[model samples]
Target: MRSFFKIQFLFLILIFISARLYSQEAENEKPFEAPYLFGSDTLIELSITTNIKELIRDTGKKSKYHQARLSYQLGDSVVSMLVQLKTRGHYRKNKNVCAFPPLRIKFDKASSSYTLFHDQDKLKIVGHCRNNNSRFQQMIFQEYLIYKAYQILTPEGFSVRLARITYKDSAKEVKNLEEYVFFIEDFEKMAKRNGKIPIYKDRIHQNNTMIYEVTRMAVFQFMVGNTDWGVPTLHNIKMIAKTPTSRPVPVPYDFDWASLVNAPYAVPNEKLDIESIHERLYRGYRRTPEELEFVFKEFRMKKESFYSLYQNSDLLTEKEIKRVINYFDEFYDIINNPKLVKRYFIDNSRQVRYK
Candidate 1:
């Protein structure tokens, strides 16, 4: 009887060890799916120039154009990026006018700082010591200031629009800005290239029709700060624009298929039932816990698809998803406790039985 009991106990011990190992493997071998979708290899080019008169007008009173030029280049490998000046000129210096110094922006990869050069000196835009953990945040904050300056200096009717701004600041007080600039002509070019011609009926400028185009243009200006520009000054600014450029045909290779399939990056156009998952979890569904657990499991297994769904989904709330992820991390630790192994087995057994 003593030997039999020992054997039974050893079997149980083996079961527990096996369960723990399988659980760990499940967690480790799980494929990572991002909750956000990301684009790849899009090129954007921008050109910044100053017309003497527009500059003078923006400055308020008539002043001579001070031989000033401003330019910058930024884009993600996956997005089509371009910037062109529809109308940019200087505001003349007046009694009320502030003497704004010319800025030269350069990117420092080593420190990841945007050093602003003016009057032959460098001004480092460092984040408060609290933000030392995130160098990207510090650089973004500095870029935002530059965007604000751009908006203030540009003309109201200017054809060039800001596209996007991306910045980071730990202090809830600081807002990081990433701005994207676009031109009206570029839109027309895009439309033509896409073989979607604007239909004009009756009205001279098709005022209502232009509204969509104008709105898109307006949004572009806000997109500019999305990339890392080495420095925060206006000098050595390289503007890259798409400029009626030919689109390259994608060539297929056997290796490309493997890369696409095995890529750890987010997949394009993958559909996920994020709203159903969110609702089942939040609305007190009977299987809320199980559903939530499965949702995360699915996320882990299909990380790329999940990321694309999260990024592309307009129906789901970003805040809700963020909250769930944060909370789930803690919950996972509790359930995976070694002391609670028996309870975990019972719970998982019940889950499997129900399924």
Candidate 2:
């Protein structure tokens, strides 16, 4: 009788164990939709549908998120990825300006951060701000090119893909329109690539971190005529660090407001002396002359390589190309000059104010 009872208990335990194993297996079998993103220069074409008028109409409230279908070419066949779409950006709220509002695409975080397949990680799509004029279209492309230029400077920067996005009215209320936009790599993926983790700690990056890389990023921002970032407030920048001991790296985005892209809304900060975003002010903290010189040398070596990107980019027409080159020429003039370094860096460098 004792043996029979013991055998019965063992049997019950095995049954319970088997049931648990089956449950775990079932969960694993469920489809984990993720995009298989790869390296290619191929321009991706995607069709996205959302109720634009409704989103714009409901200004004071949270716009309802919509299910959007994003289709792209893969190998020999077309593929589709499911994304949650919503209107995004600060300037869109202003009544007088009808700039094309940006979009925020949300993906299922359970899967990969890439957007190539079924993944639903968060990504921003930059498109025309208003009127959809030819010049606005070019501004969008200029922003795209600016991102490409940053990519040439560092692997730490966001990877952007030129996308020709077609906007279809889901309610069929607005006419179907297409615009040039770009997709940014997920921040998580970018940090993982460099063996770092994204951090949101509200401390200045230069306070207790490596100086060279921080200086490099600072100079790059100055080169692009951008002063629209602050590390402490986490405005227009993302920070990543491999360890607590290492300095955080900056991942910058939102260039439509940048002086280099020079959108209509772009303006210089009131606190800065310059009236133009085109004016370069070294926002970097003051360093020793030797230290600053080292940063200059690094930039000087890569200046040619960076300029070469604009020459190679076929997206801009001959006239547009010249305009772009001339804009950068103004920046190069400052960095290329030693006297300007004293005027911009030594005299203008901030210590505790920026931090």
| Top lDDT hit | 2
lDDT of 2 by residue, 262-327 (tens): 777778779988888777777778887788888878767777887787778777767777876786
Candidates' C-alpha lDDT: 0.28, 0.74
Clashes of each: 70, 7
Q: How far is candidate 1 from the true structure (C-alpha RMSD, Å)?
A: 26.1
Per-residue lDDT of candidate 1, residues 192-213 (tens digit): 4434432222222212222222
Question: What lDDT is reached at residue 297 by model 2?
Answer: 82
How good is model 2 by TM-score?
0.82
List the lowest-lDDT window of 10 residues for candidate 1: 251-260
TM-scores for candidates 1 onward, in order? 0.19, 0.82
| Model 2 local distance difference test score | 0.74
Clash pairs for candidate 2:
35-117, 99-129, 100-129, 100-130, 107-120, 107-121, 108-120
